[model samples]
Target: MAPVDRVDHNVLERTSLQTRLSEDTNTPEEQLKDIIQDLYQIMVQVSTYDSAGRSSREVLINEIKTLSESLRTLHTSASPPNNLPSVPPELLEYVEHGRNPDIYTREFVELVRRGNQLMRGKLNAFGTFRDILAENMTTAMPELRDDVVQVVEATGGVPPGRRNGEQSQSQPQQNGANSNHASSSAA
Candidate 1:
């Protein structure tokens, strides 16, 4: 039995092709034709060797098949419409790396928007609470109404009795705190 010689055909072909292709001044189509011819010649040369050349034959066949499929695909894809506009690198970079807007549900976005609007129209607790306190003080001590109004005005608060273009109202007939206190005392 003869010893099967194991050879690395890729190393040999790569060295030869690298030298020849580098010096060739042919057009791309001519270069591709030359490659196919060269591969065919190599396939024929490998057949003359013994069974030791089986791997090289398979490698060369697979390479030819791959190159043929690639050439076909390239021919089909090469003629894409020229009207397609090219994306600028800056815009692409911004899209890739910038802080992007979050994707939220339309309902959630609308809810937030409405909440913002309602918040914008909310009553100022400082003025509202101050007005309520001043009104309560005036009711409990009717003689202090003018002084309360003066204090409210000095502090930039709207007196409860004089809000919304209404005139300063007279003190309430029944004070809320006094009525509650009297009811509790009786109980």
Candidate 2:
């Protein structure tokens, strides 16, 4: 068979972009802004791919999952300093309720954008795994695959990793219902 040109144009572009971000960027903040934008796009693409029923884009899905996990880890590793700006309730309300706040900061926008990307990544990993499983199982048992897909969609996808029902039994329950009358009365 003659050699086929199976070139992925996006891969080349991504490599070039990474090189630029690392070497040509003027400051770390600029690099981070670019990364945040790319991550935002990735989360969007992952949603689009899943919605469009593109199960074959496993590599991209996995990359997004990994990037998301990494971002989460990095995000959680260090607590924000006490002096760092806190997200105001009004801004949060504006973002959550779709109200246009009169003023918003770039920092707030970036924080919210990163948070959204992380959430999508964390959630989509489970669905992507389910999709891969459903696709692989469909060839042999198409009907079962349909049922699997239906259940996954109906139940909003399965949680990842070893889900042990018995694990719940190991945890001892804390009974705080009958607290001291003083404590209860104080409330």
Candidate 3:
């Protein structure tokens, strides 16, 4: 099979696994929650054992047995496949500290955006400096005018008055003028 096809197959397999895992675990999670609530109610009943009579005590025992069976089923069904990705340690630590994981995600994204903005600012500053220096150099040394223009063009700088598609038609005229200027300076 082609490399691209293999990669696509892998992605589809992983997505299918994840979807199956989600569907398989959801019911067990709900059952586990209900079991915990049932246990809590049983605990309250047991705590009032004296007032709860023999019939009530038997009912509590039956409920406990039912909950125990449910927990066993949940334990078996909720076991995740070994191929599943483990949770990130940082996210676990955040949750352990009682912080919301979404807040951590937001802060991380904000930090990355700020870093990108700083880099963009630096790039813009350098580009501006390049254009300004090229313009000044071309104007100050007319004898080296062609060389300066070549350097500016090669470095992706649009010379002054040459922006917006104006450079193409005027470039030959500029080259002729530069040659005349160089010849005059040499004489």
Candidate 4:
């Protein structure tokens, strides 16, 4: 593989360009969201592989599950990912309203660029255990992706990249009355 910086830069540039799509890029505003979303997912897969490696992703994932459960007990602390991202005001207003077209004509975007950069910066973190995600993702089973993502969470990297499906699935099920509240927590 190329140097980590090279790979990371590629991913970062891809994400930035995807997220900042405008008329000059010529992608219709309607399609921009999906395009950015797809780009985000690709970056996520790369990040998962880059950060977690291929060996211990599943075990690391289980560990994160345990940690997440424990975090619920830290009365004075808060789970990190649940906080709203400090997106640019233009983005936030659209997000606040569930993508109401009337509210933000340029349309909406999930703010994953910063998360990707953070994940890249921490790509070599947590020693060898971090490689687990990459190893796990190269295997069979759709669930492999989940395991890799959980491992990323365990390493205390940024929340799962939405493009990679990591950020979205981490949310607890909204099986009850407050389903809407459970919505944005994934991002």
Candidate 5:
């Protein structure tokens, strides 16, 4: 489908027949896969709450509850067994807790079903970071954290990590024109 602006990602091009066909005309199985990806992105990335330190801590906890409820729904009807397996280790537990039923809940289920889109975004981030980090990691004082991050990035079922060392995001744009500029120069 040719996206109507708000419906698509920020790609600066027309929808190719291939893209439109793939995105628009997925099989039920494919659509289910896409939803799970979406759930992971939302829960892991966007599902955050801010507190000024005087508000309810329970608010964030409840939000996580809502997310779990949605995921439980998506798990049954849509997600693959591996990620949101039809037979999740927690299914009986969810039922006992009265979170989600066998039937799908649109609010929770839909996002979990959208795995393809979510996974792709994460993968692209990994590749971008990989290029930056691989160029910068050193022999004498290698960052142990970076290696751990790469392991996490490799898991599509979870989330990916940054290849670039921890720096203000603004630093990247400032050095966007240079591929091999070390962090010290940018500082």
Candidate 6:
């Protein structure tokens, strides 16, 4: 088979597998909802048992039987698909504490975004420091100027004093220098 055809076939297979897995994951949740609805109906029938009279007893009994069957289906469906991801303990704990899981997810996402922003700030600070240090060291030791330039270019850093447009202009030079350095180093 052609390489392109093989890749398409593999992609189709993966899509099919994911579709099946998602359906499997939802099956138990759907079953549980069905069981809950059945219970609610049975409760309603029992509550109106006296008003419903003799016929109510038969309806209540039928509802109870349906509820029993739903419970059995739920029991069987509760076995999760083998490849399904397990619930995180922290999420389970949050729910057990009576908090909404959606709130927990939002809070967790916000926490991660804050952490990422903090780390990004740190990384920017370090990059700025690297550029300033490189500029100063180049001035202090003219003999090491070439090596400093190489390091700065290889790291895709903007040299001190280069701003927006100038920074963009330097990118191609930096990329070329970086690739050359990478190839030479590999050799």
Who wins the TM-score comparison? 6
What would the per-residue lDDT of candidate 5 be over residues 18-68, giving only the tens digit for each residue?
A: 342345445556555655654543453233434654223443343345445
TM-score-better candidate, 2 vs 3 = 3
lDDT of 1 at 98: 64
Q: Scored by CA lDDT, what does every candidate get?
A: 0.58, 0.51, 0.61, 0.43, 0.45, 0.63
lDDT of 6 by residue, 1-187 (tens): 2222112323433353344334444577786776686677666666557763776676666666666766666666676666578788899998899989998899889999999999999987787678767767855775786788788888888553243324443354444345444533553
Decide which is better by lDDT, 2 or 5: 2
For model 5, the local distance difference test gives 0.45
Q: Write the per-residue lDDT of candidate 2 for residues 1-187, one digit (tens) a residue.
A: 3433443536733563454434442444554564575575465555445555554265456456545544544455434686478677768877888766654666668889999999999777766666446444644554574476566668675321112222232233121112222232553
Query: Cα-based RMSD of the predictions, in order?
Result: 21.3, 26.6, 19.2, 33.5, 29.5, 19.4
Better of 3 and 5 by lDDT: 3
Report clash pairs, candidate 1. none
Query: Once model 1 is optimally superposed onto the true structure by TM-score, how far is the C-alpha of residue 92 displaced, in angstroms?
Result: 16
**What root-mean-square deviation over C-alphas does model 5 reach?**
29.5
- List the candidates' TM-scores in order: 0.26, 0.24, 0.38, 0.16, 0.19, 0.42
Give lDDT tens digits, candidate 4, residues 68-162.
33333332233365466655676566777787654454333233666677787666454333443333342334466666657666866432233
TM-score of 5: 0.19
- lDDT-wise, the better of 1 and 5 is 1
User: What TM-score, to 2 decimals, does candidate 1 have?
Assistant: 0.26
State, as a TM-score between 0 and 1, how close model 6 is to the true structure: 0.42
How many backbone clashes does every candidate have?
0, 0, 0, 15, 17, 0
User: Which has the better lDDT: candidate 2, or candidate 6?
Assistant: 6
